[model samples]
Target: MKKKLWLTILVLLMGGVNLCHGQSLNTTAAEVADFDVQSATSNMQDLKSNLDEVVSQLYSLDEKERGTDNAISDKYRATRKEIVNVIQTINQTTDTIGEQLKKITTYKKLMLLTYKDIQASRSGMVDTKQYIEDFSNFIYKLDNKLYNENTNTIDDLKLMINSDNIPLTLANDSLVQSMILQLNDLMNNFQQNEETQLETIKKLNDLKTRTKDTIEQYQTEIEKLQQKKNYLLQFMKLYQNDTRQRQLTINNFFESTKGVYDRTVELVKDIKKWVYKVDFDMERKITALNELENDNEAYPLAWPLYPIEQIQTYFGDINFQTEYGVPHVGIQIKAGQWTPVYAARDGIVYFVADNDEIGINRAMIVHTDGYVTIYQYLKKTVIKPGDTVRRGQIIWYSWWEPGTRGAGFISKGANLTFEIFKDGIAMDPFEILDASIVKDKEALPDGYQIKYLRDKYARPIDITNLELMTGTTLAKRENQFLIKYGVGVYKQVAFREDAVKDTNIDKDMVICIAFAESTLGRYLSTNANIGNVGNNDRWDRVPFTSAYGWARAIPVTLNNAYLWAYHTINQLSRYGNKDGNIYASSPINWQTNVLKCLSQIKGYYIPEDFPFRTGPNPNINNPTPETITFGETLTQ
Candidate 1:
């Protein structure tokens, strides 16, 4: 029994040794399969990386090639045509290669080496398909990018050639040449990388270079053409004798070239902006140019009068005084009585009347130049309402009468009043008139001739208060001489008349008053207590001390005159003696009454001291009375 048991133990141990050797063989097989799978994965990765690098380099070369002269010239165009013709061939080759790659059975071998991992085979097939599609998409993108960029570059070049004022410079030509060279380099590089012939690319580059060189030569010739054009312009300017012809040529040049020049500048600006990725639109610039070209024209000046006769009165100072104690502010012409009055220029007749209430019937014409001509003291108007008249065309007839007021009143002789205005303001008519036709006849009246009468006796009229007396009431003072020889009343009448007539009292009446009052010599008071007569003190006391020949009486008398029958009947009212009660007791009463009467007549308002005089003490409140006398009428 012991011998049998020992034999069984030996058999069991031998069986265990065999089992250990089988297990070692299985582990060694697993390690070998794992190493093979790792080697295959690394190989596939390296191939894909190599393919990606090639595609990247090809894409860069294509981009550079597109800007070459070959791309834009006949060779480039022909090459493109060839490429297009062989597109199907290239595509077929690509497809065959793809199919072959797909059928590479290396995946199965790698799977076997990895043992029974079914998922590894499926993963390998997916990776291969993905790589194929990525390469295909990359090639397609490169072709499209090159084709579009080349096409666009050609179009841009064409546009540049057609634009106006394109400068032909070495720098510009050099750009085209450089692009051609770059394109040639790109083609060579592309061939080397892809192992393909760029025969079409080379031909296209040659053709483009030739075309660009020809264009540059033509641009250089254009410099000579421009010089010739400038010479012709200079010749025309020098030899052209006819002013009208010369003017027309200048106008035409400006009108024709201005639009083109401006447009060219704008176009170049937009092209630069586009190159730099700036936002711009060409349509707007084109529209603006068209508008400018259409509206370019010259404005011509209009002559005031055609065949202008001698200017009867040039604009400037005239020898005439107004009833308002002011000198004539504008020019006056002396046309013969009953002479035909014509329009100065083509314009609308703004006014026409048989009477302006200041004695002259006037017709005023307003021209487009903002100038107006007034033909005064007209007997009759030929033109009616809204009548348009041409220069030098008769519109009315001049009428002159003795003892008329303002512009029509002529102390020297019978004459018509003519006046001119610019922009509603009076200007010297002589400046605009034809000097040859209107010979400078007489010098203007001197400043001394415009002196006022009241300037000698009392003082200057208070301009600020003249409007107030129009509505004030009055009371009559009790004095016999004040009622009769109270020159105050008559003097007031003259003052009011002078104010209304628009004449300077200083020029028209001051000198006369001085002669009449003190024989133009200084007067001294007989009583020392009264102060000097010609000085300020005597004049101050005269109002309260005497009812007649008083300095204060001057303004009071002038105010009373406006309320009297003299002014109220002959001047203010169309009907004689419209109001009967006309006397006033004081200057204040006279102002109040005159104001009330004037207000009733025309709703006119008078200033606070309408009839008051301007002086060192114009507004003194002393309860004084004064008087003044009327002198003979004086002419400016």
Candidate 2:
């Protein structure tokens, strides 16, 4: 009966804990939703204000033009000047509207980023809540077990003390007193355990409450952004419509003014036909401005770094447009942290640190003829505004810490965001930048395109840059092949790095030959004979002390034995048939397998070896060249 009662209490406590978590989760979700609504409203208010300013300018222009029409007949000469003034005002207002639209677009992107932050925060909260729930459950189960056990022990001791029908001697009396003390101790321990559990639960509940409060603040921000976004959308629609109508009005006035101004010029010219005709230099400033604009195209910019590991993001990416409501304005070069950032062209520093509010540390260089290059997410800067820098000069260092304010949330690791702008409008950096330094660009065959063998091999698959690639990335790629094929010789060995460091042979050729020789050492004898050198008996094998020992020996063995026999796989296959200088029993088969593995290891995917499987799984004790033929090869 006592156990049944305790079980009922346990069930009630479990239900209470669950109820508390459920209520807290629901409240958090609601707050996040509310934040979105408020954010949208705020955006709308800003848009509405900008729209009003544009509309007012349009209205004032319309009134001015209308007034000029009213006095045209009575004061035709005086109205000519007024018409010129109205035309100039219209041009200025049009520029103003364009600037306003750019601001609205920027705000839209900010709101989208806010939404991403809210989602990340909510995910973190869910994880924290789950931890608290599990912790509470463990504590509750322990508490229930202790309570039941202690209660039964106390009841049994009481029954023992009450048992009678014997003399009350000193020994019996002392024994009863001892039983009473034991009961008291058990009760004290039970009470202490219960208190400890309560304290633990209390601490856990406090942690949960603190977590919720922090997220609540974030949710509040989200709500404001959501409301602003909604409000902005409404105003954007109104602004678009208003601007369209105003544009038409301004266009009509422009044409009207042009015709009137032409007639007025002709009338005045006849009246003062012989007046002093001094050639004015009115176009001097305009000519200078035009020259500056054209200069941007004449001189192309340089790449900030050579052999870039990857392009993280490109200009005008569709994904960027969907997330930010505007196309990306720059290219993000994936580079290592602290890598030097160079100036794209010869230019004066315009801004050493712009867009800091978004946590982007950047530098802008104003190049010749109105061209500007922006480098963002830099760790350190060495130049200040107004300092002139040459093309390819070091300007800053790259940043790559993820979750840091410096790198922002979207960009994960070390990268440089490079942008080119001509007269304040963003241009594609790839389109305008010079490509002389990127040798990999010209390495691909006419019809062939670059592709990754796997996402893990993050670098570009350019044979030219293969040796120049980072050693760690190269080693990781080589290790994958070794691990997958269960190659005993090259497993956990830096074969690629060592081969490149020790020999002049192609990295791909070395790895391919190893695969063709022994499935990358999987079938090698315990001696770790990678190349099967000096094993002329076909089934024979040479030995090395260790995998690294074999790695060091293969490059030397290849250079001495094979370099004279063949420089290329094609030549080697044809010559392999020669009696004494032969490298394989079936030259054609050897060539086919080597080339197949060669292409795969060089950033292309291929299926497993078929037909006669020489891999470790089939348990081939020894895989000879004659036994591993792809098929009956054609006689050449």
Candidate 3:
């Protein structure tokens, strides 16, 4: 028996060189066939459980076919039938693997789209929540601004009434005449109407309260939606895990075939070596051909400002001035006038200075990572020293000579000088800002919007709030203004665009109001009061703490008047006067003056005439363009 076994083994190695040698994965795939989901798990599990028995059956079939004596046809047929059974099981398992692959692919796409939807919805909800927050904040802000104006005016008016300024001097002008007539009327029926005016005050606060509730409704809905989105995302992740397990099972099924296939190839290789046909390491060579796919790495940074000049000044070396050798200390980023500069990183403002000598205003900030980001040539710095600035916060407005031909600019457009310092050494910002190293813009797959993980997760600690508003410190007031970036910043709200979108106020009205209130921001020249005026009646905006905050308050008050009093313009006369607000107090010449100011601003209505003054007629119940509430006209 030993002699027989040795001879058999030697023959096995020496013969069967004629077996198929050139094998392909596709050829093996043909043998295995497609997979189906149902019964697939059982099929693979059965094959795995009975693997040894299946192998023995296959060898028995081979031996029956290659036997020396007159073969027993019955035994051969039985052996063949047993081998066919094992093959059927394998085919069923392969078919199951195919089904799993298709299912996994479908699931992957579904999960990807679901995750993307969640991401998109979350981003949008965050923005909507902010709008709701702004609406809520605007209410108390409006109340505060209006209350201060009203109380201060009443105090002065009481003093004047007791003093000897009787008849109110030269009260012949139509506006003043109207006021005097109302004052005389009030003197007679003061007690009767005081209750009515107080009722009006209640309605004002009530209207704001209702608006606040409406905003809260939006908040509630967004929160619920956010929760639902999160749950769906979690379900998708679990489903993906299940699919990955199925994939591993399929790979296990593949491994079973690999062993048998390798044995067959080994026989061929032994024969080839005996014949000296070839000497290749087929396993290593074939394994090398399998390509491993890599997951994509996201681009980690972004451009500082959205809209900027195409050609950015290189960071390392540059000459801003050849003759003066101005030693360009940083990269110059060119953007148009009123283009707000955002904080590139979360930081605290350290040093702020207006260098009139160099015609440059700069704000220096120290970041949490010990890097210092310096912004130069700023038109204005909203935050003061020690104020924490959030990433993407609008810290400064671009310094640009609007309506003038200026020098030292690219394409005659002003540039913001940006620099980064680490360990007291200036570093090239392009090293971080440029996405080319991580992945070039063109290199990204088609229809892909690459977003940084950092961008998604990096959010600042909430320090921009009423908690900082002590109604005293200038820095604290400025901090409050800075927090309301979209509504109060120089660029985003340069013309108060955010408020205009959510209110009845228009750009034309803002320009006019700013001109009327602060002489178009000139009042801010001494203090931080913008486009405002106080005739000791109802125009002082002292409680706001900053010009930007004061400017934002204008729209809130106008919208409130539209909602509560149904009046479009300001009124100071008695309760029944529709045009009784401050706008009507300028002797009807107010419109002409407002027109002049509106025309001077960059974008506003022509100064041909004042459009919304329905003189002596109440402003409420009149839905005219530029005066009507946005709700009454086109919904913005």
Candidate 4:
């Protein structure tokens, strides 16, 4: 029977060798590895239990005859030594052989599962090759441990289990029990590690599948753009330069190019993430992949607007009807006009639109880890599409109307509608915000409340609250302003500080004009002229070395050419050189809008600080610029 067992084991080892050469682990071998050593442990457990029973029985018999004998028996001494030797052997085998085997088995199982996931992805052979190498090494080590190290240990255990050594002393039995308990603990730890690794592998497989789908979608989009461009090229040839359709065709071509470029950029970001995964160690790789998977469905890490006074509407609020006339998809926070809003997380601006019906200014940002945030009803947006924003960076302001009561009379003040999306599905803000809105009252500053009053039109309007105000000197205020809303060249702290100290013009006037003209550098010309300093025709922008250069030149340039501009805020209407020689298309309210922004900065209405007076409306055709203001118009 022993000969037969040896022969069978030899055949299995040979088969395993063949399989290893072919770069695959043998399932029969793995099963054998799992079950083969368990019998040895079980035999050890039985022997230890039997020895314990024999020791108890012998102690009872010895207690009854203790006075009669009174001397140690030679048989008892020999048996004690033999049992001591066996217990020591058992400890050694459990510590070295049992521990090694468990580690190898656990690691092999992890590699196998990961190998299967990689294979199912239909990846190339190169991806599976490393796992195959690992399997081969583990199998070799396991074989050596089983055949070489476990051979003498198993023989010793068998010899120690004879009837002669059954009557072990209490001390010997104690040692045996301790070793068995230790082996069981090691086994439990091994099982837990295996379970954790398996869970991580499952998450990694899901992430790989999602990544593949996203890449395919990008490819499809690029193909569509290519087809559109081809058709436009044919259309352009017929129209030539003389036709009005010529310019339209060129614009279509540019749009197609931009679409392809954007898709490529997004695809590259995906590739980089995959490369990042490959750079980590095996254990770290598993942990990182698990985290990446979780992040894909995680909530936003920051609030869209800080220190909000009230939330008027919550996500999925069925009782309340939003301007869209549908179940609310996001929460609405009531804020004072031009209150600064920040990006919820690090992300690239996906979409930016001005004058939307539901919200005046709207933005949708897509984060790297599968989160998307939407901000609507903004009075102004400082960031542009494709711009990367950091978490907590200012991107826009709350919606408000010009020429209205303290609170926006027409638009109901600044109502910011915020939404968070995970994996393209809307998530309840309360879940993502971790119920902070309800339980975390400390998140809001003291006295943070919106005060309301009735306008001349008998409508409730929000007036500016003190919490939004800042009290500081002019130079120091510019630094805070740049930090809160600055972008492009305007973001340079040292340059802004120097300009504020050196420029003869009012620092607030330059900042307000820059915001009104280019949204604080969002609409700068290639020359970085943030305020569109010189080139008139309204649409053209003159270049400057830096925002500071344009700022310093503001007073000089206006004083030299359009000297009437310094006379009053309305005189600056000639700066843009639009129709009827106005500064902007909405010429009548431009000065008032700038003055209101300045007042918001000062925390009080201070229009006279600019030393300017209102004049006749400079615009030609438009009688009303604020008539169709956003947030007031609710289009679903």
- Top candidate on lDDT is 2
Best by TM-score: 2
Q: How well is each residue in 48-158 modelled by candidate 1, as lDDT tens digits? A: 343333335434433444545534433334323432322322333334433333332343343334333323433443454354344434433332321234333324454
Q: After superposition, how far is residue 308 of candidate 3 from its true place, in Å?
A: 3.2
Give the better candidate number (1 or 4) by lDDT.
4
lDDT for residue 344 in candidate 4, whole number 0-100: 72
The alpha-carbon deviation from the true structure for residue 324 of candidate 4, after best TM-score superposition, in angstroms, is: 4.6
Residue 31, candidate 2: how far off, in angstroms? 51
Steric clashes per prediction: 63, 27, 18, 2
lDDT of 4 by residue, 283-361 (tens): 4433443443213212335566544446777677776433323456678787765466777766666567664221135
Q: What are the TM-scores, per candidate, against the unseen true structure?
A: 0.21, 0.26, 0.24, 0.25
> What's the ranking of the predictions by lDDT, best on top?
2, 4, 3, 1
lDDT tens readout by residue for model 3, 209-230: 3333333333332332232223
**lDDT (tens digit, per residue) of candidate 2 on 14-70:** 653232221112222233223343454454345335544544644454454445455
Instruction: Give the lowest summed-lDDT range of ten residues in model 2.
Output: 610-619
Candidate 2 off by > 4 Å: 1-299, 354-358, 435-636
